[model samples]
Each structure stands twice: as structure tokens, then as C-alpha cells.
Target: MSDKRRAFESPADLARPITQPVLRRPAATTMGAVLVVLRVLAGVWWLLALTFSWNDVLLDDLGLGDEPDFQALGNDVKEAISSGILNTVLIVGGIVLVIELLFALLVFRGVNWARVVVMVFATLSIIGSFVGWWLGGQEITVHTTLVTLALDILVLLALSSQGARAYARRPRERRARGSVA
Candidate 1:
């Protein structure tokens, strides 16, 4: 009778060196890529919130509320100042998010450089957030920044795993099927 499945491998076969690279992507790599995507989404969510209701968050911006002149300014002037600040933040922040997305795409494709970039940046961001909170008394609220911070930490961990690193560093397979690939 013909069998579709091959018999179990012998010890010699198992000990033989691997000539071909694996085609399957590791779970760690895929998870890291997905985490980065989610992190970018969190940034977009807050950016949109700030863009639309910036007036609410600007009451204490740069201590402008403490300025007698700023307080005395008409509602129109106050709104313009708030809008400017929010627009600046959104413009710069959006650019950063887009860059993150590009690297994430490469990571999903098993690119080692992109994985390194994502992990390094995530580490730096986590360190910076703690430094800001410690030195600058930056608030760490559970609603927004904390959630993103957790994601950053998770991304760093996922991309740094051995499975993810090995998958990224493995030899790339040639696309042409007829030749020795």
C-alpha cells in the first residue's frame, strides 16, 4: 500500500545539518510586527482626540493659563494659540507614526534590520518615558500614555526573543523555482 506520510526520521537524519532555510515565519516575529502596528494605532487614536478637542487639554498648556495677558486674551486668540500647539504636535507625531508603520511592515517580512530598529526604538522610548516621569514629573495616566508604554515594552520583548532573531537572521530563499534555490 502507498502511504502519503513518510516514516519517522532516524537519529542520523535528525543529526544531519540543515541545507535549506525554513519558509515559515516564527510566531515571535509575527507578534512583534502586530504589536508595533497596534502601538501606532494607539498614537493615532490620541492624536485624533487631541486634534478635535484640543481646547479642553490646552487650559494648562505651557503654563499659559497662569499668564495674566493670556488669561485676558479674547476667546478667539486663545483658540488660535491652542490650535497652533495641537497642530504642531499632531504634524510631528503623525510623521513618527508613519515611519513606525514602514518599519513594522519590514519586520513582518522577516527583515533583521527592521526588527532591530523596532526593538531599539522601543527600548529607548521606554527609558525616555521613565526618565521624563522621574525628572520632569510627567504624568503617567492609565487611560492613554500608560497603555502605549505597555505596548512599547511588549514590542521590545517580543522582537528580542530568540525565535524572532533567528528567523530574521536566517538565509533568504531565492524566488526562482527551477534553479538551485
Candidate 2:
């Protein structure tokens, strides 16, 4: 070996693997996660509204007019409709809420796939809302519809931010290096 090459020896552990550290979660990602949680809260609001006002909601949904005399129906019919509406709401609403919660948690963890999934859902929701409104099928109330729309918009903006996207799409080595406690 030449004198320069023999001047120093390489570290014995140079070939061994060394874990890299993962950077902290970005603010935009945190915001996106929080926005998702807000969406879940909106879902809860709808569930509660349906739970408390199933009769009026059922009437409105079924085109029974704003002030239908629903009480005039026979007891059996009333009970049947009431139970059906409540049961449907509970089943469907509960499932959606759980799924939203799971996605929110996943987004908070900086999972790229989760972020993309949320973005897709948000886009769909925005488009569907506009389409339904244009067709005179969906109502956009200030208290309910508008609030949820805002949440979805915010979620999209946050998750689609440069910082959020970079952090979420970061290499697996960076992500896994410091993931363990």
C-alpha cells in the first residue's frame, strides 16, 4: 500500500448499518390531522342530530313536507318507521365515524398513503357537495353543511402543503430510524 493509503485505517464498523433519525412531524401534517379530527366531529354532530330528531329527519328525507302530521299514522307504522330510521342511522353513521377516526390517526402518523386517501375523499366530498347542490338535492346550511365543507377544504389544503407532502413521502429509512421508542 502507498504511504497515503496506509496513513489511516477505516473504522471497523463502517460496513455495519446505522439507523438514521426521523425528523419531527411537520406543522402542516399536524394541522391536517387536526382538520381530520374536526371532520370526525362533524360526523358526530350529524349522528347526534339524526339520533335526536329522527322523526323530522325521516319526514324531510321521505318528502313528507316540512310539517307533515306524522303522528296521524297508525302506532305500528310510526314505530316501524322510527325504528328503521334510527337503526339505519346508527349503523351507517357509526361505521363512517370509526373509519374517519382511523384515517385521522393514520394521517397524524405521517403515513403517505393515509394522506393520499384523505385527499381523495376530500376531493370527492367537495365535488359531490357541489354536484348535489347544483342538482337541488343537497342543502348547504350555515350550521352543518358549511362547517363540514370548511373542514374538508382545510384538510385538503393542509395535507397537500409542501411540508406535509415532503414529510409524509419521506424515505422509509428516515421514517423508521427514530420511530421506535
Error of 2 at 177 (Å): 15
Tens digit per residue, CA lDDT, model 2, 1-181: 5545243435553333334434878999999999999899888888888788876766777665444476577779878877987898789988988998999999999888899999999999988889988997778887558888888899999998756876776656445565875
lDDT of 1 by residue, 1-181 (tens): 7755355656675445455575788898999999999999998998988777676576655667688989999999887887788889989999999999999999999988899889889889899889989998888887647988999999987997756866787777568867763
TM-score of candidate 1 against the unseen true structure: 0.76
* CA lDDT scores, all candidates in order: 0.83, 0.81
Of candidate 1, the 10-residue stretch with the lowest lDDT total is 13-22
Q: Candidate 1 regions off by >4 Å?
A: 1-20, 69-75, 173-181
Candidate 1, backbone clash total? 0
Q: Candidate 2: lDDT of 26?
A: 90
Predicted structure 2: lDDT:
0.81
- Clashing residue pairs found in predicted model 2: none
